[model samples]
Target: MSATSVSSDRVDHLWKGVRAGVPIFVASAPFAVLFGAMAVENGLTVAQAVLMSAAVYGGASQMVGIELFGQHVAPWLIVFSIFAVNFRHVLYSAAIGQHVPHWSPLRKAVAFFFLVDPVFAESERRVENGKRITIIWYAGMALPMYCSWILMTWIGAEFGSQVMPDAHAIGLDFLLSIYFLGLVMGFRKRPRWLPVVLVSAVVSVIAYRTIGSPWHVSIGALAGILLAAALPPRAALPLEAAAVEEATS
Candidate 1:
């Protein structure tokens, strides 16, 4: 192929990623605004709220931090709470690492900064369909979401409550959860998906009932990760051997 053709391919892939990421950003945009408003309400300046969104880029953890900050909680507990809420990113990085072996250390560092749930899901879906995870494509998807999040945060800090009056009264809080459910269901066809989902759901509920909010989310996810790692599909050699042994026994 000519250099011109290669350039065209890169732009095309980048555009494809941008298109793929729009829906995610659209779904998440409201929550960004909500965080900004809530952050301001919780005593953070508009700049601080936007900075946190830009730097941390993790919505759940950001909210947890904001709430803790509002309560004048100790700095250590607030940091620990954010870490607990974001522990799933550790699992996400581990899962996606195999697909990006060609990436340089710096590239991986930059790319992983935008590794939210939607990005991780969409990347896995792209890989499952046999496409390589190109930098152009990843940035195309990531930039819109990342930039829009900060933009929305500013808007919310400046005009969120004034515009919406009562965001929760209108049920904006449920939108992200609904969007998350869609992401989870997108992987339903993967091997052992349902079992992992069920186990995670059950464990999450149990943890919520006993241990409480943020911990339940992380603990539930950890349970699912453990199950997925320990119990491969029956087609795998170790699983096949176990099946054979059980059958003979």
Candidate 2:
């Protein structure tokens, strides 16, 4: 294809990725609204709310940050905690490193800012055909998600708590467990993650109840990493093969 035709085709392919992201946006919207409301109620300013959405762009990590913020944790510690919670992004960078080899330094930096767990999960799950993925597709996904986050945060900062009465009694806490369980189940079709789930959950609950810190998430993630790393390569290879098959097929 001519260069112009190739560029156009790439744009079209990216639009498809954005369209595929719609369902995820639907899943994320309510949670973003909830986080916005909670952040504001916990005393974050509208600017802070929107900034975290724009800067952090991490739903779970933002929630954890706000929880720590509310607990009167030092700002530096809060920053460190957020970093620890999101450290897994480094692994994601390594995984996709070869795919986007020609990306400029500035482009790489911009892409990292918008990276979040769901974006990582979905993109990794559905990489396209022989055509190398372009930066435009990643940006397309970030654009809407970023807008929704800040818009929802602004709305909630201004009005969410007033409207969302007795939300605590409704037990949305269960949703966190449910959501994590769903993710685990999604990965559990393979055997390796079955142990990862069991060990991670057990480690998480113990850490949460004992060495309580907003940073407990880092501990749990480390537990999974350590356990997964320690698994016999022979035993883990089958699960890895299944995951690859699922991703490719």
Q: For model 1, what is the error of residue 195's alpha carbon versus the real structure, in angstroms, after optimal superposition?
A: 14
Residue range 1-249, candidate 1, lDDT tens digits: 999999999999999999989989998898899899888878999999999999889887898788778878568878888887677577667767778999999999989989887888788778879999999999999899999999999999989768777757876555546645765675565567788999999999999899976567668988998999899456644432322222222
Q: State candidate 1's TM-score.
A: 0.71
Whole-model Cα lDDT of every candidate shown, in order: 0.81, 0.70
lDDT agreement of model 2 with the native? 0.70
lDDT per residue as tens, model 2, 113-132 = 76565666556665545555
TM per candidate comes to 0.71, 0.75
Mark the regions of model 1 whose C-alpha exceeds 4 Å error after superposition: 164-249
User: Could you tell me which 10 consecutive residues in candidate 2 have the lowest summed lDDT?
Assistant: 240-249
Worst 10 residues of 1 by lDDT: 240-249
